[model samples]
Target: MLSRVANNLIWMNRYMERGYSVLNLLKVNYSAHQDSPDLFPWTPIINNYCGSDSGFSSENSIECINHMIFNLDNQNSIINLVTRSRENARSVQEHIPRELWLGINSYYLYLTKPELPNKLYQEDPVVFLDRLLNHQLLYYGKIDITQERGSAYYFMDIGKFLERVIQISDLASMKLKEIAKTSDALERSFLWKNFLLSIGAYQLYLKKYKSTFQEDFIIKLIFQEQLFPKSLYYCVNKLSRHINQLIQTNELVNNDLEFLLGKLQSTIQYTTIESINEQGLTNFIASIKNDITNISLSINNVYFSNQS
Candidate 1:
């Protein structure tokens, strides 16, 4: 595959996944803020996840939701992400199947419509977010069904799960940071549940843990659960496998990517939650984020463009 084609395919899916991550974060936590406006102040979450809650009319739910979804100036907004995703896909249109291309383009067109912002804040916020969320599902499902299982397929999958690994870790860190500030048990559970729902892991979490929601158990579930698709461990392992496949195909000798991936997986496997507690969750997650950033840079250096 051409490097440009591979890069576009990779980035197209990365932006899509990222957009979904942000929108889903809002989706899972929105109703609670709506129900109890005072008991729960949502500014911390907005500030932590969406950068800052500034420039909006108010930090209320509608305004905050608008900021995350419709503020084109915010580089990470859903519309920007979908736009980037489609543009990248456009760069490699020949490589993409017809149905997948149509699906992505259709979603992008829906988001770019001028009425979206008003519809979100005035008519119904959940419906707008859900429509976007469902679009993500449909686009990915089209990819699974239509795209051939080949190098292009592997590259796009790598992009999705690579972003997944980072997002899963980062969201956990953010929710845990919020959880630490609260004294009430109910609030702790609410934050934890939101974390699971954001990643579409709530039911799987319930089936596995059943009775316990301890910090240790939840950390283990997030970081170490091999069977769960959204776990950090699972994403890392899958990413390593995809990169290995790419290396063989491209005939490239890049040790940095493999070594970092191995070290990350080993740390997650051997380190216990007790040891993580000693380091503290904030510091621990910060280290994970740093490591993942380094790995991403190394991969970009070697494979995508401007090869070292």
Candidate 2:
């Protein structure tokens, strides 16, 4: 594969994954703020996940939300992600099919228009989010149906799967900490539901467990479920499969990347929630984050960097 094509494929996946991440964060924060009257807390979420929240420096809920959601200065915002994705698509327009590029371009242009953000937030936030999600789905579907199943496809899969693994781990860590600290069962239950909804896993959870919300079961389902797409284990497993396939066909292998992924996957596969909680959830999550960071660097070395 050409270096330029590989770069485009990687970036295309990254941008879409970022847009989805921002959308999920916005939805979760919005629901939490709306449901809990006293808990008008929003800044912590922005600060933790998005570095741009620091610019606002205000504890006010509405102000922080507006700044995070609408301010173009926040490069990680939904609009900004969409814009960047379009720019990435533009850069590789010659490599991608014209129709596919046009679809992404049109979507971002619509999102970047001056009036869309205000109208979206004012007219109906949920509906606006739904529309954005639908567009994301459309782009993903287009890639699946239109793109060839080759090195480029594998790179795209790597980007999407890795992003999902990191996002789910972060969400689980954040929400589990909240649950552990909270004394009120009702609040815990609400937070757990919100976490599931943020990952688009609520309905799936209900279908799989057929039981009321409980912390242990929720943790198991989110972290360990092999069949669930958003689960960290599932994402890592899928990533490994793709990487192995790439190695086999291209005769290109990176031992460091494989070792990191294998170790992370094994840890998740064998460990129990009891051990995780007893040992300290924060430490376990931090370890996983380190592993992921290493795996990403290895991936760049093997497939993305010019030196590779």
List, residue by residue over 1-308, the lDDT tens digit for candidate 1: 77678888888989988888888888776876776665445676566655664544454787778777877787777888888888889888888898998998999889888887778866677787888899999998999899998888888988898888878877877777777788999878777777788888878888988965677778888889999888888888888898888888873356688898888888888888889999898888888888888887886776676321
Best prediction by TM-score: 1
Count of clashing residue pairs in every prediction: 0, 0
Count clashing residue pairs in model 1.
0
Residue 148, candidate 2: C-alpha displacement in angstroms: 2.0
Give per-residue lDDT, candidate 1, residue 205: 80
Estimate, for each residue in 43-110, the C-alpha lDDT of model 2 and write its tens digit: 55676656643566765545555565567877667667677678767877766667778889878877
Candidate 1 at residue 71, lDDT? 79
TM agreement with the true structure for every prediction: 0.92, 0.89
Error of 2 at 288 (Å): 1.4
lDDT of each: 0.80, 0.74
Best by lDDT: 1
